[model samples]
Target: MKYVVAWRERPTGSAAEYEAAQKRIREVLALWKMPASLTIHQFVARVGESGYAALETVEPADLQYLIAAFAPFSITVVPMMEVLDVAAGEPRGIEWRNGLPCTQP
Candidate 1:
């Protein structure tokens, strides 16, 4: 199973707050003994937006831990199972069914 984790700065959140949260998250990861299942990680920042986005592909079992790790910011977790190549008109890693791609459980 794979998960997509996204997080953005809270509307009322300040840079100091975000930095503090990141410090805690780093500490947690340092002391945490878990499998390295993350396959992809991306960070995005818009030119004018106050918030940023983080996208990741991780194992199902690690979803809960990631959510807890990013608790300081607004985040969303989505389970994804297939990667579709629209230009090639085919699925890259998993199959599609009923005109919709399957989601990870």
Candidate 2:
């Protein structure tokens, strides 16, 4: 499954504190060797915002580990299933049902 993991660094008392937080984040990633199951599509900081957004294709079983890897940062994980393929002209008539994609007759 694919997941979007968005995170924002928690506010800190000083620049030193923020730098420490960054260091911890890097350490955690290195410690885990950056999970082999995850295929990162995009990982970038949000411009004009103090946060980051990452899109990755990951196995469901590895999801928890992915979340835990972020450690102390405020993070949100959204499970996503592609229901449309604009390039392929898929789901010509589909709709969102209760926040999920569904085909319409």
Candidate 3:
């Protein structure tokens, strides 16, 4: 089972502590058994306000392990399902090819 793990941080009263904690977090994730083929990063728009990360090939049980290991930080996990297309030319079933060889019939 694949999972997309998004990591977001809450605003703490102390800026110094938050910065220190955030740095520590980077080290923690680096040490974790994260998938090499997935994308992971902190939320750009809301820098320092919140962080974000996306992960794949992770199990539900692994989430619990992560949360426990990274105590005091709020973590959110959302499971994703792969789209196995049995009927199709495209998974979404949408085509917009005006001059291409493959046109919708």
Q: Could you list the CA RMSD of all candidates, in the order they appear?
A: 8.9, 6.6, 9.1
Residue 22 of model 3, lDDT score: 79
lDDT of 3 at 31: 89
Worst 10 residues of 1 by lDDT: 49-58
lDDT for each candidate structure: 0.58, 0.68, 0.61
Please identify which of the two predictions, 1 or 3, would achieve the higher TM-score against the true structure. Answer: 3
lDDT (0-100) at residue 62 of candidate 3? 58
For model 2, how does the per-residue alpha-carbon lDDT over 25-62 read when each residue is reduced to its tens digit? 77886767555877878778777444544456546656
Tens digit per residue, CA lDDT, model 1, 1-105:
545556665553778876776688678768866447655555565554433333443356566776676566577766654455343555532355555755867
Best by lDDT: 2
Count of clashing residue pairs in every prediction:
0, 0, 1
Off by over 4 Å in 3: 30-52, 85-105
What lDDT tens digits, residue by residue, belong to model 3 across residues 2-104?
Answer: 5555556756779798888879878887887843444443333345454555555444565677677776577777775556633455634544444358555
Query: Candidate 2 has which clashing residue pairs, if any?
Result: none
TM values, all candidates: 0.45, 0.60, 0.50
